[model samples]
Target: MKERFLRAGAAVLTAAALGAGLSACAPLVIGGGAMVGTLMAIDRRTAGTQVEDEGIELRAASRIRETLGDRAHINVTSYNRQVLLTGEVATAEDGQKAEQIVRGVENVLSVVNDLGIMPPSSLTQRSNDTFITGKVRASLVDAKDLTASAFKVVTERNVVYLMGRVTQREAKRSAEIARGVNGVRKVVRAFEVISEEELQRQLAQPAPVTQDPAAASAPARR
Candidate 1:
């Protein structure tokens, strides 16, 4: 009973955190402290690559905004230097343009442009998507067989996009969990599939240590 209560509390807190970020339309920082530290420890990408992914997302989003302006409502998510482009574009040409701009960004290993050619989603729709994303993440957290932090969850409209460097088993399991979340219209994967051996090696490595206590306490960007 106590365990269930704790899980419920975690879900609520996580949901609230995620909702705040989504409503603000900002890049998400999943959580702080031990939870995030654990996630960072198990993440497949090197520390440098994780930082690079953040840079790629910021630069790509900026360029897209400058070039496409209000014509696109694009969400940029990068994992292991690969980018996933979601949200709506005014036209098919605008979608292509957005992809081109991201590809031109430095150190972008690849791009998956999943931009829909449609009008921007309503605020209500975005809020609902945020709720779905939060629920999916909380569900993953509650699953004993998975590490929730390994997956990056982003929802647009009613679709949930999952990005990670995961083995096929982890990818399949994560997708199933996300699909079962309420209000999720679709589940999309932009995963970098790694072998089980590689995953085992990652798990075997010690968590990174930092001299800066603040940095050490913060969640490592995936």
Candidate 2:
């Protein structure tokens, strides 16, 4: 296990370095790679804490997928002990089963099952989602304006969910990129920002704003 972790760590570091190189125009892919690398590193550093959490999350997701038996397409994301399940299932029972599986995971503090009861994933939707995720990742990788590692992207039914700790500007840029991705229906932000003091400090920096020429002329005329 220790040897395996060492290998994983090396791979993650390599990915992170590669991701940094691609961060300018492929922020999404870089962000995704960074997220994965961070998770792997955490698991390596605190093998007991994170490995257990990951095991539980993956086990639960696999069980739910198996139980659904080809009727559903589920994506599971685990963060800090929280599990988010998204995608579609064929029936309400299948959704419930998914919830149960995630809840049964030992270290899961909470489970947000955003599983919709719908038909299996269409080829078109799958293809579009793949493309969107790839592009968004690429954008994150290439974005110079924000820390690409501070956001997480999840796509379902063409809508993109952005989550993590980021400044308002970072969040806005992330949303903009997601919106610009072809076939994206919507962009949702679920971010936690820094304290008010930090936000104020950032806001104090110079920024360009449009001035109203008519108002200036009116004041001069008066």
Candidate 3:
């Protein structure tokens, strides 16, 4: 799963770098498609975290929520189908309930429950989030060297969440474009990459590193 995510991330970054050099008018459509593709690829790779089990947890959670009513607030994030269930639930039982529900889903390798006991987001906040999401989407569509679809753009309090398969250069270009978008307070990137081989021995290996979410979330450009 990790290997797949790494590869997808590398591909996205490569695309982004390539997009960056493209002329503005030419990038309007292709960039957006590329971005979406990159994001989808990353999502697909992460779904393998359970070693082939994929999106099982997400499906389970959705079904559980539907059965239990909409009161249970849960956010499901899956990478290669390894599910991370975050957000708040009403009670300890609810948390366990979610885990059980997710576990029952086919292909779910594991579930990481980061849910807290809290209320759901207010309507106004949800509206704002939606607006931000739209803006980011539009910006990506309009920008050159950016694929609107290659990125998973999530907005929290005006801060953008960028997750996708991308190369280092593409990531940088994506960030710059996001920073230029209006109403974006910041951009957070949970991007992975493939590094150059080391010359230490006859056989070299890829260097591993955790992506810093904050690095991509810097304040919007002026």
TM-score of each: 0.83, 0.61, 0.48
Candidate 3 Cα RMSD (Å): 14.6
The residue-by-residue lDDT of candidate 1 on 1-222, one tens digit each, is 533544664576566756664575655555545544444455567766877988998999999999998877898989998899999999999999999999999999899889999999877777777777778888887888877667888888888999998889999999999999888889998898989998888888876852434765679899
Error of 2 at 148 (Å): 1.2
Q: For candidate 2, write residues 117-167 as lDDT tens digits.
A: 887666566555655666676666566675454555677778887766566
Residue-level lDDT tens digits of model 3 in 82-199 = 4566555778888888888887787666666656677765545545654666566556656656544455555555666666556676578778877887778878666544332311
Clashes of 1: 0
- Model 2 TM-score on a 0 to 1 scale: 0.61
For model 2, the stretches where C-alpha displacement exceeds 4 angstroms are 1-53, 167-169, 192-222
- Over 4 Å off, model 1: 1-39, 211-222
- Comparing 1 with 3 on TM-score, the higher-scoring candidate is 1
What ordering of candidates by TM-score runs from best to worst?
1, 2, 3
